[model samples]
Target: MALKRSSSMKTQLVNGIQLQEFEQEEEINTSSSNNTPSEPAEAKAHTEPKYYTVEEAVETIGFGRFHVLLFVIMGSANIVEAMEIMLLAVVSPEIRCEWRLEDWQVALVSTMVFLGFMVFGVLCGYVADKYGRWKVVFGGFIWASYFSLLTSFSPSYGWFIFLRCMVGCGVAATSQGFILKTEFIPAKHRAFLLPLASIFWMLGSMLIIVLGMTVVPSMGWRWMIRFSIIPSIILIGLFLFIPESARFQVSAGNIKGAMSTLDWIARMNGVPLPEGELREPEVTERGNAFTLISPAYRRTSFLLWYTWFVASFIYYGSVLSSSELLEKNLLCVTDADAEHQIKHNHEEALCYCIPFNMADYQTLLISCLGEVALIPLNIALLNVFGRKASMAILLVLCAIFFMLVNICTTMFGFTVLLFLLRSVVSMNFNVVYIYTAEVYPTSVRSIGMGFCTSFSRVGGMIAPFIAQVLMSRSVIWAMSPFAAACVICAIGVVFMPIETRGRALLQHG
Candidate 1:
């Protein structure tokens, strides 16, 4: 009786399982039949490609070997710019003697380069935005190289001024290279790496000084200018290896080209391409001068332009005034009247082709090295304090140093103050670059940078007048304005509406 009952229970259990399976199948069929119209749509949705933005793609790739390569290649732009700008300060003393130029004329040589930089600054940005970054960069390299080479062969001061101005045009165009670089860099790496890129600038500044110590003294200023062309030549070749910025390409509506470039970057970096279709960046008003002044950007633009102007004024003031300061300290001119008299006599003579001695070069080199030494500090402040605070702090410190520099009675004292001044001013400049790149959207980035840089060149255009010309008359005139400008910039920086720390870049205006 028990065996029979066990056999019946086993049968019932198997039958129950079969019934449950049948019911589930029936329910599935009923559901599928009822939802047939939506079935294909759901399947289609599953099969469709995913979309991603440029920032999303960059984040996935992260910083890799490819970025390191880009950093070096794109950072070459800073190096080249530094060499050109520093060459003015290094070579001007010699040029003055060669042409029997007055102090104002000597100042104008430096002024003209920035004049061209100012005039073409906005234009280059527009061209870069409408066209592409690499084209502008590549063309700029060519334009600058040709004109810079011609500068060495300049027969008269007028030709030299014109050629230098043309070089400035190229330099202004190349400023877009920074924008191109900023696009590729992930936000996480921006604070550290962007400030670190100033190492290239420091290297370039030092290189010109080294050449000042060696080439200008030996082969003459022409040869030094001739030799500076070599970096441009090398850079033009390296530029071939790097691709156009994917961000710019996407914003400009060349999605396929952007995808290809991104794919190449992925391959080069030993990573897989991001798993999606590259979404087109949102359409916005094409970047123009008006876009910069739009309500969205107006206050930021105003503040940023002023900040750029101040940074350039203080930085170039420190640099151009270095030679004069060194001269004053070296002469041991304790009295203000005597210092003025010495400068007057010095300007009238214009006979010493190279005013810098071995000691002067050593001092200049020491001061320049301060830029490198303080870079780690700058990076720290950027990451810790954030961009706005860092800029304001540096500007304030710069102002204090600029004022303190006025009271230095000994070479050691002046060199120390100048070193601090260069360090802070350069740090502020680095912060400004990073901040501007972050604040603007991809569509108007280059134009925004160019516009701000144009204002900087305005400061640059005027800096020589004070640094080289007025500094010759009174130290008070040169240093005081830079100090005042720094204070004003510091105050203005506090009022910026946005803080770009760890912020994702905007794709559209």
Candidate 2:
């Protein structure tokens, strides 16, 4: 009876153990089935990012009415900026005559603008990258237009200088505007399209000349400045139409905003996103203008800044000194009697004179006209020789012209050589803008440009004093430094390791 009871207990215990093993196996299978598709799909949905690059966005958005409208409206800002720069030249003569201001004081008024650029350029750039490109555009234009208009009403030289300085501080948006345009353009078309902005710059300067010929002589430089605001006021209202950079929005982790921008771009471009979703561009950690100095970027960053300084030194140095250049040429053209006869008709006397001195407005107009050829030349040179070759060659050409300005003795020779010099230097300036934008990554593009431009403003601030001191001795003294600068920058271009031609914009430096 005891053996029979023990056998029944053992059978029951084994059956219970087997049942427990079977239930455990069934539960594991059920969990695996539930997780394999359901959890993995959910995890992937959660982990994968949606983002796009500038090039991809360009492909989707393309060059169409959207681009035309945006860039056109944006070009208005460039026009405003150009007018501000040339305005110093336009008003300097009148201010000098009216205030009985010394040559140094006239130069100081111009120098103050660049000084403001030196102070505020990097700050504006940082703000553009940290905040938004459109904000920089609007902010710059608003500051520039308001102060510029107020400048026309200045009661004294001190007030005029301060207001003009504010305009320079505001016009630092040139770098921001350049980057903003680049971020939207397609890679294949970038080099060609980017130079088109120069045309608007040219037009803005030419507008000042038109004012000089028509209104400036009759009314005054003040009225000309006030009249210049009409277009700017119109442009400010249109700022609402330009879109913020989708690339910037994405890097900022604003996915919804990026998407909304991308949708508008895609709708205009008539293309779908890659794999039905955008993927974030791979980038290093986010940083400020100083980030450009990191080990990876140090060589390129310093190189660009130095080159920009050199270019600005030569370009703005030449521009700011242009008023005096005409005076030098006039020495050979007019005797005491001719000068006496023309004193009353001086404005009308040179209105159409071939051998006459190039007035400040005329000099500025000639400078602007030079940009008309920059676009086509940029297309050919950038496409054929690549960025390095084009920039180096252009700088060399500029150097040759600067040397000619010193060598030439006659009025015709000075005028022709000076015109050519302005043209070549303008081309070089456009090249620098294109190259700077191409080299830096979107991560710090605007600030990087601003940093480089800020250094250029350093050169600009010193340019007037240098030109003033040098011109008193001889034109050669003023121009020699710029010739040396051109040579130095030309050499720098040869040493650059990267050529950004036909490549997508770098995501980060």
Candidate 3:
């Protein structure tokens, strides 16, 4: 059975996530007192009391209508987040034309967004833990969406970068969303469903492609940013519909709230609450996120952080430089239409445009199709192979495919390899989220996630610059480092001791 909070009230007060350990006592005791006191106080003192675990109950209730509804509402953030992350690519060409920006400057604008992740990740994680997950998530959505809208109005490169950085800070609530999803999901389906978040992410990227091919050619980059903000704005209004994690509420010591939350879930699933103690008495202790790296969990902590960093570097670096990679393939093939257009009106040809164009948009769209296909593949991998082994296998394969970019001189071969690499890398990254959510206890789950993500942002920050420099020389130079990183990470994942395949979320330290 998994443990949740119902520890002493003081510990709840000191807990960083503000779990409200004693908040539901009056209501719960009123109902709890009605039931006969089953165990004698003396006997209870001598042995471990029977405690109901929320994990088992959630598993029994299973996912239903409410979960699906929440999936759409809460998970919408991933789409919005993806849109912001890739939005720079959609607009960079227009921005470059207007500002007379060089390749380095355009890359800098894209890189600035992730830089915010590095600066705010740890802080945001702590806030989520100390306050509540939903608060951090709501705040992040507001910050990201508002800045994205503001960024559209930027009068200069400085303003654009600053607002873009703010967008990253706002989306730092990412860890909170992942943790919340983990809490609500059943163990058997956890790994499989978590990757669905990436599907929304891919959708966001595809939406941008549609806009770029249609909207950007006519209205402008500013309108593209504004268009992306519409979802975020609408989601903010729909925020009230999503529920707080009941597991979190119980872990915070709000037994009645937890029960009520569970009852709500049970009702949503059209089932009665399962018979079990939902929480157990715990001798609570307060600690910081550093506790994760303490003697007991240090190995798990470091390994997760290292893998997170490597995954972030490979994924972000690939995405940030994908256009240039596609451009390499584009230049290799002869396009009569592009040539004819360039011969007539150079600026009007999306394919002949200097850095990015309609050809790159088509490539991005095709790559997204491959990513979308992998949602089912990822679900199967997590179920059949489990988290760690699946990640290791995919990482090694992704590394091979990414490096093979060097040998694929023809457009078909190059594009095929790029699509495969993107798909596998997407799977690898989603596995990290599932693994991270299961690795840590609820007490510091968000913080642990945030810390690992911070490491990712560190990679996120530097990967683009590295990609930019190597890409200036050749795509081979950029891809070689990413492929090597993938190999190193693949080797590292083989050493991970935990395999979160249908296992209970590790609760106590």
User: What are the C-alpha RMSDs, in order, of all predicted structures?
Assistant: 4.7, 8.4, 16.8
lDDT of 1 at 207: 88
lDDT of each: 0.86, 0.74, 0.76
Pairs that clash in candidate 1: none
Model 3 pairs whose backbones collide: 5-251, 16-129, 16-130, 17-129, 19-252, 21-252, 21-253, 52-277, 52-278
Deviation in angstroms for 181 in model 1? Answer: 0.3
Please list the residue runs of candidate 3 whose C-alpha ends up more than 4 Å from where it truly belongs after superposition: 1-51, 282-287, 327-355
For model 3, residues 83-197, the per-residue Cα lDDT tens digits are: 8877866676677678876667767876777778877888887776666688888888888888888998999988988999988888887547878777888887776678887
* Distance from true location, Cα of 393 in model 3, Å: 0.7
Clashing residue pairs in all predictions, respectively, total 0, 2, 9
Off by over 4 Å in 2: 1-54, 281-285, 328-337, 340-364, 409-413
List runs of model 1 lying over 4 Å from the truth: 1-45, 281-284, 328-354
Per-residue lDDT tens digits for candidate 1, residues 99-149, read: 877778888988999999999888988888878889989999999999999
Residue 374 of model 3, lDDT score: 78
